[model samples]
Target: QPTLRKLVGGSSAPQLPDDSVRQLLVEADATNELFKYCEGQGYSLFVAAQPCSYTTQVVAGMIYTVSMSTEPDPGTYYEIKIFKPLPHLEQKARVTEIRMAQR
Candidate 1:
């Protein structure tokens, strides 16, 4: 799995530090109920982060968007998105934006 920094930074954006990436992973790990559920159902979970504009609307500033996807199953998979505000911001909070679609 690519680090959150790498996923969000892409090829041109600024990269997040190692500590920041670790922090994001920790935060994402704390909310792994969906991952556990998927695993229980015999699916592998893949997670990565990306820059998201919709998160700005929810958080009022830059946000790290983490998405989890499962191995293909009948041309469908589960996806969950988590939003984390930028570290420089005073918010220092995390939010799970959405968890939907099954089967």
Candidate 2:
């Protein structure tokens, strides 16, 4: 998956429309807020994935998994994961395909 920074910067990357760019920016802001919240809660943040444009209506943001303790005991380790979807982007699938025939 290409990061938003690379997608918007590289010449070879598909040029996104202005509205899509704006939407991506909004998602980025939301991601930042989530990071701050995790920090305040005393958990170390790890970004599992950077935000990426999934489809015309959707821009998926980072996946975060946070953990606080480093104890070797399994019971002492706990992790909280979070990924917030863009509300406006959530939609029903519009297309379905059967198996493609091989030549």
Candidate 3:
């Protein structure tokens, strides 16, 4: 199951969005970044990347490993890794890797 963390200072405060929420956002961002790092390189995804699933690695920062599929093309998926540095770092998030996923 996805974990939900505390969002506000008090116990009664609402919970933060879980991994599923993060994955949806990541899918959108990854599609845009794909054009940046993948288009000319041969990854010509003709449609929006629909989120399939994703995993997260937490270190000094967070690495999001996302699997997405392009519409009208079943069985074709791409793996995108995005890094989000700690809040203290003040660094902008970036897409570290974008590649086709083997079946």
Largest TM-score belongs to which candidate?
Answer: 3
- Clashes (N, CA, C under 3 Å) per candidate: 0, 0, 0
**Residue 31 C-alpha lDDT in model 1:** 43
Cα lDDT of all candidates, in order? 0.45, 0.36, 0.66
Candidate 2: global Cα-lDDT? Answer: 0.36
- Which candidate number would show the highest lDDT if scored against the true structure? 3
When summed lDDT is taken over every stretch of 10 residues in candidate 1, the lowest stretch is: 48-57
Candidate achieving higher TM-score, 2 or 3: 3
lDDT string for model 1 (45-82, tens) is 56532222221223444454433334444335334344
At residue 2, give the lDDT of candidate 2.
62
Candidates ranked by TM-score, best first?
Answer: 3, 1, 2
lDDT of 3 by residue, 3-31 (tens): 97744332233234367536545544667
- TM-score per prediction, in order, is 0.36, 0.24, 0.65
| CA deviation > 4 Å runs, candidate 2 | 1-28, 48-103
Residue 30's C-alpha lDDT in candidate 1? 29
Q: Considering only N, C-alpha and C atoms within 3 Å, which residue pairs clash in candidate 3?
A: none
